[model samples]
Target: MSASERYTFREVTPADLPLLAEWQLRPHVRKWWDTAEPFTAQKLKDTRVKRWIVETTQRPFAYLQDYSVHGWEDHHFFSLPKGSRGIDQYIGEADMTGKGHGPAFIAQHLKALFEAGVPVVATDPHPDNTRAISAYKKAGFEVFGSSQATQWGLILPMKVSSSS
Candidate 1:
């Protein structure tokens, strides 16, 4: 079946912390996500980020987050227009990688953010993560430049603006 037909999104809750931590330990996920340190439930709870679990018809298979750029302190994104949101996501299952799911779900989430009145959305992937950069590009994001303010160190800053 098609990716859109097989997958959906659900709000992440504290109950899902164990699953998230497990996913963070996956080699594929850790390579780009940099989960060297243990991922704790408390850390998830303390962050202002909003998260979602991407599920297939039968089970959760990915993690996604959306956060306000302006709400963060000492970052370069303040120059973006107000109401800009930023996104980070990954398909947790190794089998789920390389499918069209990444771009499809990213587009789905971007539409939701835009419809919710966010003027723009951005993503910063480590410069060498070609897979993520390609997916973001397919999801309608353009590489505007690079940034050093993020934990990822050097990142390729990408963005999409609401047409409305």
Candidate 2:
């Protein structure tokens, strides 16, 4: 990505369900995500999770969701500080991965959250998901805890601070 590259996120709408479902079933995405079933217009109306279809002005290519770490009672990221958010996302387009879109878009989104007064951003990726770990590292996230097994699966907790 270049310094001038642009990224944006728009709230997922009911009209986006089919495309999201299509993406969720792709080999590239299906390997890491299983989000197709509950992805209805009603799911979009949930106030807790802020879901977005990630875009690059040129086109949309991914799905991303961020929510308060404490929103769920037993979430792996529950120990993060107040106002901290946890994110899960995947590139829908096979061509978009390995091209730096993950880090670039994630960093841009983190910047927006930080500017909006979020003190920290956290993510817990499967321990073996090297691609995701690498992208999060490039986005300024650092591993902060040992990997643990939870309802979400085995995750290696990672985080980035607004002040960092």
Using TM-score, give the best candidate's number: 2
- Worst ten in a row by lDDT for model 2: 29-38
Model 2 lDDT per residue over 1-164, tens place? 45644877889999999999999989888877765455988878878799999988659999899999898878877777888999999999999899999998899889889989999999988898999999999999999989999887788999999999
| Model 2 residue pairs with clashes | none
Model 1: lDDT equals 0.83
Supply every candidate's count of residue pairs whose N, Cα or C atoms clash at under 3 angstroms.
0, 0
* Number of the predicted model whose lDDT against the real structure is largest: 2
104-132: candidate 1 lDDT, tens digit per residue: 88998888788899999989898888999
What are the runs in model 1 whose C-alpha is more than 4 Å off? 1-6, 37-39, 147-151
Candidate 2, after superposition: displacement of residue 51 in Å? Answer: 0.5
Overall local distance difference test of candidate 2: 0.89
**Candidate 2 off by > 4 Å:** 1-5
